[model samples]
Target chain A: MENRTAREYYENYLKTTHRLGRILTASVLILLLAAPYVIGIYLKAMPNIPAVLKAFLGVGIVYLVSGIVEYLIYVPMLGAGGSYLAFITGNLINMKIPCAINARDIVGVKSGTPENEIIATLSIATSSLVTIIVLALGVLLMIPLQPVLQSPALQPAFENVVPALFGAMACKYYRADRKAALIVLTVMTLLFVFVPSLIGSTSMMVIPSGALAIGLSYLSFRKKQKTSEGGNEA
Target chain B: MELLAELNSPVMYLICGGIILFVSVICIVFAVRAYRAGRQLGIDESKMKRVITASTTFAVLPSIGILLGVIALSGSLGTPWPWLRLSVIGALHYETQVAEAASEAAGIGGLSIANMTPEAFATIAFLMSLCIMWGMVLVIFNGEAYSRRLVSPSHPEKGGKKKKSGMSGFGDTAMTAMFIGLVSAYIASYIGTIVSGNGMFSFQGSWLPLAVAVTSAAAMGVFIYIKNRTGADWVDSFSVAGSMLTAMAAAIFFGRLIG
Candidate 1:
């Protein structure tokens, strides 16, 4: 009876999250377009439809695929409320994802639990708010901070932010399953070495690498199970 | 450049500022809801506070990186638009690429402010706003269903008893694998530059990124060691943020040494 009550609460919470998520997302979408439309109208310089379409065709088609792929790949990890806020606020790969993952790990919450969902949402929300505050500060201080921010001496640090971030993250996560990590890392390294252009497609590559790791882990699990069974028989 | 001046005008700032304010309010609302739900779920208050503090710390450096993106784009796209783009749904690289493509397609010749007109700005804005909006749309319509499907498989609520499928930890393993795949690909590409003598960065063939990554990984190792030894919970909270800043600082030293 307690389990049933818990299940009902979880279901109701998800239902409320979805309802709120859809409404807020739809509202934000309108506001996003409204920014450009209001500007165009205010300036009395509306966009030419043909030119907009042409420009969109040049890049939009590719990003359309990317948008869909990113949604599918990231949503599972991000959970419900987290996904809604994250998609709206953006910067998933660099900021939101890492923040959510770190919070979940720190609190020792398993993915797919109510605890995990709440943690992910809290972390993502906090990250988003921080980003907004930072960006606002940047805009206010752009003049004073321009030289420091745009200095040649600082370019390397900014350029290498991804490596620095992921390096630390990888260290933490790889310890969980060293064997799978080794196999995936080696295979990915070899693949990149051969087809260097694939460097640009790291997001898409996660699919195959994840599948390979899962397969290897499953095999290891089976092997251990069989070993225990054989020892019992002996 | 008349339009460029107007683009950065007070009205533009107001619009961008308003949008950011709206987004911020939503963030606060969600955060509040999540915190209440967490308390209901019996999460320790201190743990949730730690999550908030750690997330705030982890966010600072990356947010600065994004600020730099705004600064970069502002040279061509004006301050307000780039600020809005970076603060909201757009990334640095994507925003740059799309703005360039839209400007060129609009016959503005590129992302040069000299040739930017209202019409061209409008074109850029439309393309930038339209193309990236699909992700939000997908999340709106499909996010709940997708999340339900993802969690139901492993959820204890779905099955009253835990199943011993020998696949107990696969979700975490998969997440870790994806991250490893991402980092390895990045590290390998940097190494590949050394092998092929061609890379995307100006300092091609230099071991800059790989060296930076190694230094960062070492820093992380040190943080983890310290956390284990001292039993300082704050070390755990600051590990990633501290490692990233240390590695970024070391990047300057490495850049000078290697380049």
Candidate 2:
């Protein structure tokens, strides 16, 4: 009886959230419609697409596909119009090369509204489109280089780049949230280094590292609270 | 010892040292920038130091492992051993597949893993496995979430609040690192495969490719760290520079070695 009551309550909660989502979706759609026209004249008068247009197109294709996905999933089915606009703009933001200063504007307006929900829903959709487009352009742009992504052996080398980039970012992150950063970084490092040894060659190291980081960070938080309380009493 | 001996080769040392040095210098520069940015942002200094320490460790250790692995493996084998190489590549490919599959299995989160070709499946699996493995290692070592605040020097999140960096953007760095570390490896493999016309471990020229692969892996690690620290602007410049250098180095080194 108690379990049944809980389930019933959950269903009611879900319905309320659903209704809320619909209202938010409508708000975002309204915002999106106004965005382009506001800047459309300037967009029209803009100079020729830079040679970087090719690169933008590469990422843009991916973003476009992602937008299409959003259209199908949210705009059409879920009735999320505002997300459609956010998706379009997000891709545009990503496509800008050398420095697209528009990310702030694109993602910023999302605060404290139904727009945030829609944007969150469309994030992956936008990323997928952008990634695919960028890759296509990358292939064409990098044709002169030849065999960079094509060859089998070299692909592994390419795989490593993402992690290195993350490592660099980790350094910066560490500087900001020292306690949490140290805890997570240390946890991940241990995972990357020791897990392979423990589980043998077949084991995947990164997952454990990421998990460990999150876990340890959580525990450390509790430990910190305990210590701080003890100090207060002393 | 023999592995160390081969690593001592001027060319090999140059490759290893140069790459490591490049990465270290980039990290140091970025760390300083991050420090300044944090200072400007009013992040506590002690907090910044801890983050830096964690980031440095994360960046350096995996990289050293990868670099040393490449140098040692290459030096010892003198030829790319198909089985070992295949397994490593297979692992990466498979991990990626697994991640995709897991996401898809969640329904609406990803494309169906069942639909992927064998190669694609392997790739996803490789990525997923790596993530899992690394995550575990991290937990065992220190047990933290590895979250970091990103204050875009140029683009701040809404209402001037800082945004947190996630692992999603590391994909770009992975691509760059792969090119840098493995172009020669790719060329070698392509030439060997064409010459031999064999399948499943037929590609040759083990050292160059392995080195590239491992270094690229290192780059992925470092890039992740860097992306979290610097602005996208910085990432773009660094990526372009890294890619160009990787291509140039591969061209020069491969030309000399294979010529």
Candidate 3:
């Protein structure tokens, strides 16, 4: 995508991707709602409307603010078709986003290119397919595999899997701009330590941490530029 | 058939299986499109193939976790809805919490198949789906604008190329920051409990999660070494998964030994 000509090629294809992405996303929602509808139809039971509202309000309200924030934070990083796929497939922060970043790193493409767009989409789509296949197999094999999946020997690992994952991952990007990564990491860590309850609200915290990282990285960028300019002058 | 006994019944499998199949079809369709786009954009053919392999490998471990989520919820909600939910963006963290909240609101005694009347179960499903759509709706309507604005400052013009920024590009920096922020939040949560003396592992002196993290990071170092020394292209594919699996194993051993 960095090749200027490649971007022009994107212009040729963007329309179809965008239209399909939108329609697919809309259909996913309808199909998702259809789950409950079908269940209700089969059982001859419609949901209690007031109860639905109450539960929705109770569950949905807290998530509403965070959901919007997640959308804003993730969409740009992922790009057009990738966002649609990742959002519909879910597991953005935990799985899809990291998978995308890793794929880009391995393939040596940076963001903001048509190539990057393609890479992100490809990796996420790969991830989604793998997830579905693996899960479906697990569901079918549930009785036989339950012991392995839930083995006490592996329970501890599953419990702390998130931390293990990010520990391996967070080092890659932050190392590029150590100062920024450190600053954001320290601030966020301390904030969470003192306010432990904030752990549940990850979506909201992304904004402030992202703001600080960008702000600090800008300073480092300026210094690096100044040195380069000085070398040129010399 | 009594609804309770049918919680894990064939009908439920058909419904859930249909959703998974649909998601898979969409995923493959887009994957092909992305491949074509990659070729047009001049990405190396081999590199694109490697990306698919790497992503699939990386996805393996997490998919196991997600499967566990479906299994966990199936005991109560039956396999279908949980399968449908987890298959499509319904995370364990969110699915369990929201489902429980809705079940409680519907006055189910607990999150149990026995306690779930069809009506209560319907409410849970509807409310859960209804709530989760906030991000989806935004993506459909305004995703392009939001994403465009994120990178627009660098572009400045519709047809122009990006200016080389002296600083870290906003795209990379913003993403890095968010990642650091998110992981920090997770780590901090564990530490917070420890500092407050509320952490279960602390009394036992294991620092279970931290140990797991360090072990995983170390395992990643090993993976990195394997990648570098062997020049195994596949090593990069397994780095994250290997790190996670090894750490998990270490967590169990360390937890039991010390605690």
lDDT of each: 0.82, 0.31, 0.78
Tens-place lDDT digits, model 2, residues B125-180: 22222222321222122221110121112223322232233322232222222122
Considering TM-score, which of the candidate structures 1 and 3 is the better prediction for this target? 1
Interface RMSD of 1: 2.4
Predicted candidate 1, C-alpha RMSD: 2.7
Report the lDDT tens digits of candidate 3 across residue range A83-176: 9999899988779989998898888776766667888999999999998988889888988999997887777777776777877886555566
Q: Order of candidates by lDDT, top first?
A: 1, 3, 2
| lDDT score, candidate 1, position B71 | 87
What lDDT is reached at residue B246 by model 3? 86
List residue ranges in candidate 1 displaced over 4 A.
Answer: A1-6, A221-234, B152-168, B197-204
Native contact fraction (fnat) of model 2: 0.00
Instruction: Output per-candidate TM-scores for chain A, rounded to 2 decimals.
Output: 0.88, 0.36, 0.89
Better candidate number, 1 or 2, judged by DockQ: 1
Ranking by TM-score: 1, 3, 2
Q: Write the per-residue lDDT of candidate 1 for residues A1-234, one digit (tens) a residue.
A: 265666676678889989999999899889988788799987888877798789888888988987997788778777899999988988878788888998888888877778788889999999989989999998999999999988888889988887888888878877877887888788877776676677666655666776677677677767877898789999
- Tens-digit lDDT string for candidate 1 (B143-217): 877887764443555642454455555566566666666566666666766555374333356677777788888
For model 2, residues A122-213, the per-residue Cα lDDT tens digits are: 33222222333332233234445334444544443343433323332333233434554444444433332332232221112333333444
Give the top-scoring candidate (lDDT). Answer: 1
